[model samples]
Target: MPSDVDSTADEQSNGYWFRRGLAGIISAPAFILMASFVGFGGLAREAGWSAGEAAFITGFIWALPSQVVFIGSVAAGASFGAIIIAVALSAVRLLPMTVALMPILRDPKRPGWVYYPASHFIAITAWVVSMMRLPDVPRGGRLAFFLGFGMSLTVCNVAVTLLSHQLAGTVSPVIAAALVFLTPMYFLVALWSAARMRADYLALITGLVLGPVFHHVDPEFDILWAGILGGTLAFGLHKIMERWS
Candidate 1:
């Protein structure tokens, strides 16, 4: 068991290093989204929000869809509470992701102060790939590996965001669309590769089918309900399949 664990840790550490480099390359498209934000921010400048406020939302919110929703909804005369709720609902997907990741990326021996800053590096795309690769890593080194990998991605994201703001006009819309697509494309591929077990496969299918269906019914609650109800259903399905076999 100990030997197996050690091997797994080595694999995970190596995997993280490999993926971290790939992530940097794949994440180049995200620069286009950054450019889009700068353009939008420029437009918003005259509407009411100051440049700092625009930059803050772009930087601190960090979630593109939610940031767009918040800014657009407010611009359209939505109440503050509604805007907040919209953003919160959009980000609710992070909760399960965080739960699923904590064990894999956590160092039980380390204090909270370390993980506190480390958690900032966690993002949807990175979390998905990291989770997929983590099982091969040993528990002891997984957290440190993630810290290095995630920090790399974060630095790239920030640098791109700042660059986009400074050179928004230089980026074409086609390139921006491509960049925005990179995150999801990477995630979809990683999620597909990670579905090695029945439960995970069912969860993926359930989430995919339910995401759009629930979105049409109620955009705000779709992710939460899909993750909860679909996940539960998938779990039950997996158990039944196992029993039958």
Candidate 2:
């Protein structure tokens, strides 16, 4: 009986490490890079941006929605103010990520230099998953783990962007479209996985319903407004639902 318990505990520990290793393999930086090739870089080429410049932006920005808006709006000859607003709206979610993560990821004794930039790679997917999983990890290891994971993502994005730029001509448009679509598809899947609260569920459903409707009216503002409006409405409705339930 004692041996059986010991064996089971060892297996569980090994399994935990293995899973964490796998999770580190799929970093937000990597996903952001993958999205860039099919989505933004291709569009950038189409819009006359030099491949090097687009790839540079991809490596630096690592924010897909904002990059998309910046590229798309610029392509359409939008004004500086319009482009700024579009990018700003898309990037608003970054604030929430930083707020939620700082308390957990920041080490009390560590200097700001190391932690400040680790905070930069804390995107929606990374932040959400880390929030869910990092608490279970030993406090000292969380930052190290996320650093490795986030850096892997950043490096992969640059590599993949160059590869995508070179290979874009070889692939069919359909495949390219699917590759671009994967980022959002993954996001929805992540959102679904993280939906423990009623407000999150309602927000997702409402946002999906509103996305198309708002798009038809104004393509530029659709995603931004839909998320804001739908999320707000979802929050309100969730409160009512809870009170009445």
Candidate 3:
């Protein structure tokens, strides 16, 4: 009977991962990215780029913010050197995100080279969802789950970029452009579910409340200031709560 019970549990674990991995393929953020791609496609078309350039940019650049900066700089008649600098600056946020996420997703035995390809999938949407869900995932299944989730988003991104290029000329640019805002909106909702610690929750709330205010004062440096202020306050509040408890 004990052997039979063990077998049943194993089967259940397998089924759980199978279903969970499949669920990642059609996750909410995938749709969010699809909507955002419509805007990217529109931007490419508006820039008078061909569908190939749109596809290449989505596939190669991958980061939406960098892509947006590239488009904007080119449209404004910026020099090539300035465009490169702006796009690189827009992507500076990724370094910290990569640092935070790699340990959670990496397998010690898996060679470093594997991460080269895998790193491509570490976009904000995937990282946010993966960080939140990875603890619940069986350790061995984490990579498989992320590959499925990340691949789905990437494939959808490429497809939508190509399709958007054609549709951008015909579709309402304003509506599609507005959809790009969905990424941050979803981040707010996702953070609500994912925040477990008081410090984390407080930090998130502070960022949300003060983010627009800081941006109003200084759009260029708002994120850095908000992060510093929110993080410091959250740490202090958490320490106070711990001492009181």
Candidate 4:
């Protein structure tokens, strides 16, 4: 029922947002992500993976932790089944991120199936940036913007991984290792900056304080328990404060 002019305007709006999203690669988070992947590429090469293999993993898994787990497991001679389990467990953390972002990116008029592919790109970098930026975008074009941003990051990082794999020895091992920490450091800062609720602050701080303790207690399951306990404590405190107020 819309006129041609109206349809054209809508297209233009979508294109504009998409371009803006693609431009996100020039931002700090994007740079940090790519730098971290340079570390990953070096690690992959050290682990004896081919450039093609490293690029494939980056393009498909698209999750640094999982990719690292895969490379480490292979290098350690882990069984195929064990490697699969390790990678899947490492990636479990992304589920909450994807769940939180779905409502913001979902468009009522679009079919739900479209989001499945979109969800594949929901790494910490994409999720954090989208959560911070998508609220300002028009609801109709949020998906377009996210797709542009997410897809561009994936493509760019994969290329970086491949090139880094080829040029692995050029970077010192210690420096490459330090670079790998940048993504998580950036994630923490970005999460803190984007948090709007007291509960959010509580969860982050509690997680930060407890993470080391849990790591000492059980290095294998530290992240899982720290997240669970931190989140539970934060929620309880928030509820109690609400009641008292």
Give per-residue CA lDDT, model 4, range 36-123, as digits (tens).
Answer: 8887887787788889988999999998878877776677666787677767766886887888888888777679999988788899
Report lDDT per candidate. Answer: 0.61, 0.68, 0.72, 0.80
What TM-score does candidate 3 reach?
0.65
Per-residue lDDT of 157-193 in model 1, one digit per residue for the tens? 4555455444434567675555444545544565677
Off by over 4 Å in 2: 1-23, 26-48, 136-138
Rank order (by lDDT, best first): 4, 3, 2, 1
Q: How far is candidate 2 from the true structure (C-alpha RMSD, Å)?
A: 6.6
lDDT of 3 at 75: 75
Clashing pairs in 4: none
Off by over 4 Å in 4: 1-12, 171-245
By TM-score, is 1 or 4 better? Answer: 4
TM-score (C-alpha, index-matched) for candidate 1: 0.54
The TM-scores of all predictions, comma-separated, are: 0.54, 0.72, 0.65, 0.71
Q: How far is 202's C-alpha from truth in model 3 (Å)?
A: 15
List of clashing residue pairs for candidate 3: none
Q: What are the per-model numbers of colliding residue pairs? A: 2, 1, 0, 0
Give me the overall lDDT of model 2.
0.68
lDDT of 2 at 215: 80
Q: Report the C-alpha lDDT of model 2 over 17-127, residue by residue, as the tens digit.
A: 444634675655445445644555555655677778877877787776667678877876767876787688778868877887877776554677887767767665556
